[model samples]
Target: MRRSIFETEHEQLRDTAHDFFLKYAVPHRAEWEAQGHVGREIWRQAAEHGLLGLEIPEEYGGAGIHDYRFNAVVIEEAARTRSGVALTLQNEIVAPYLIGLGTEEQKQRWLPGMATGELLGAIAMSEPGAGSDLAGIRTSARRDGDGWVVNGSKTFISGGLLADVVIVVARTDPEAGHKGFSLLLVEDGMAGFERGKKLDKVGQRTSDTMELFFSDVRVPAGNLLGEQGRGFYSLMRNLPQERLGIAVAGLASAEHAYAVTAEYARTREAFGQPIASFQVNRHALSEMHTKLQVARTYLDQCILGVSSGELTAEDAAGAKWWITELEWEVVDRCMQMFGGYGYINEYEISQIWRDARIQRLYGGTTEIMKDLVGRKLGF
Candidate 1:
């Protein structure tokens, strides 16, 4: 069960992150949940503590560490703590687009603020008409003199409510089909950019989820990310990393669930003995533990594959679907050990269960991931 992924530095990072979240983030979870969004203060605090932008360059106010394991440590610690902040959304989902695609001028304008956590980023993909169907996206950007005029809306935008910069996916050439799509950087207070109502979700209440409205907003040509009409491919390239992030989160949450449940079974009694003393309960815990270890092994390989640029979309899809589905089962089984307390909103397991549901849905639905992998297998 010992992980070979972390070096001494990685463990050092994990220890510091664990301590910081235990002190700062865990204590504020309730208050942040009440607001339905994490405060910018927490983001700034994380940055000040040197936890927010490990992948960004030092010139841009970051540690300039390119290792993905370091990134995984941040994500794993966040999930383990149930911090309710979507660091994955920022670090895994949006940072690459900025780092890999941003022009020197664009980097100058945005990267420093991002690395410093002064600017939060979000990638707007799903629309009112498109969730899994990227081809169905209706958000459009038309070429205007010296700029592009964008018009459309995005929903289910993670980190939307507070993002200082939103990387919007829009159709740039109506006739080019899939190649028509492009990424546009829409900054805060852009003339026609508006944050819609904060969505009320069943879980992960502290992470902001919302709709975004863009009405004939003029984005300077300079703000376009990557080559125009290459957005779809760009997004596809990033999907592997994004899905891997989800898988790691799934593993972390499930592991946390198991730890909590195992401790409960050891202490909570039934028939004058601990519930764990029962054969059926013991078997259930054993199965969940074995499943978790297996999951970690494969996921660790996927992490290494991704870090080495050798992980294929198919491999990432397999990890995302299998691990998330297993995550759900593991958490559900763990919750059963708590009996009625599992259903109570007060228990930590209850929140973990609620939050785990979306893992299979977002990034890519389990069904979609299966089909993707199936197709790659000559199905």
Candidate 2:
């Protein structure tokens, strides 16, 4: 399917982004994976390339483009190259929240550094007990004289080790249910802000995921983002873009998986003939092609709708759940086609298959997405 969403400008940006990934990211994949995180220099290199702040305002060291398709392009290419942490997520997932909700003083203090890669950002939302149930989080911030005393724990935080500033979600008023939540920015070097061990994960090996502990960590009143007790609403507002981003990567992974498997099938032989010549292999290829094409068409339209501010949360949820689930399915089936070789780390398919597992789990689970969609339908 032909995608009409991107203009010539976006196309040019894609080419540039693609080249950047190939040069800086592809060569370091193995080392980064071995080190358990991407090198910090890559973040600086990306900032030099003007890839970190496309949505930020011009005065704040960004391109000032508010369009989402440009953001989508960066994520798509990053996933295509399997770029590691602090590349795609910093720009697409975490940056926008600060851009959209942070105060002018906050923006002045953080945006320039963020764009220049002098500062790294991470959002702390998921707790050990609460994944999708935002209202159930027990992390609390009690009001003090001139600041808030924040004490809590956050697990599964991306960029946790490298984050210079973390936007933490906590309950400001325990009895208010959803209305009690708020967002606070806790900077590095703050007293009593302790980082836990980097977790061992099944995939996304190079992306640092860590646990964070706040033991009487005091955040200044000015560090609060938006209205106190309004963080849930704020989270809800931004979740659509997050889901859209996941959808972008999910389908891209599917397409890449299919492409790689197709190449392998053509070269590997069975019964003195290429596996690609077999009817079973041909049928599998046909099905994968059809599924990916349909998913791509839908996701491209969602990207356009998001760029124009016409995309709804329900629409994004549907795309995220359906497309990522499809990515998991296609990658698994494609892996099976490789026989035992698919399970080996040396094969790119194995890595992709492992990496694709979180697609259905993160950015809200497929079950949560369906529930959101169901609620939008008045269920």
Top candidate when judged by lDDT against the true structure: 1
Residue-level lDDT of model 1, residues 163-228, one tens digit each, is 989999999999999999999999999999999999899888898889999999999999999999
How does candidate 1 fare on TM-score? 0.98
Q: lDDT for model 1, on a 0 to 1 scale? A: 0.92
Clashes of 1: 0
- lDDT of candidate 2 over 1-379, digit per residue (tens): 6788889989888888889999999899889888888988888888888688888788999889888888888888888888764465777767888898999999999999888888899999999999988877999999999999999999999999999999999999999999999999999999999999999999998999999999999999999988999999999998898888989988988888998999999999989999988998899899989988888888888998987888999999999999999999999999999999999999999999999999899889999999999998999
Flag regions of model 2 displaced more than 4 Å.
Answer: none
Tell me the whole-model lDDT of each prediction, alpha carbons only. 0.92, 0.90
TM-scores of the candidates in the order shown: 0.98, 0.98
Model 1, residue 143: distance off in Å is 0.4
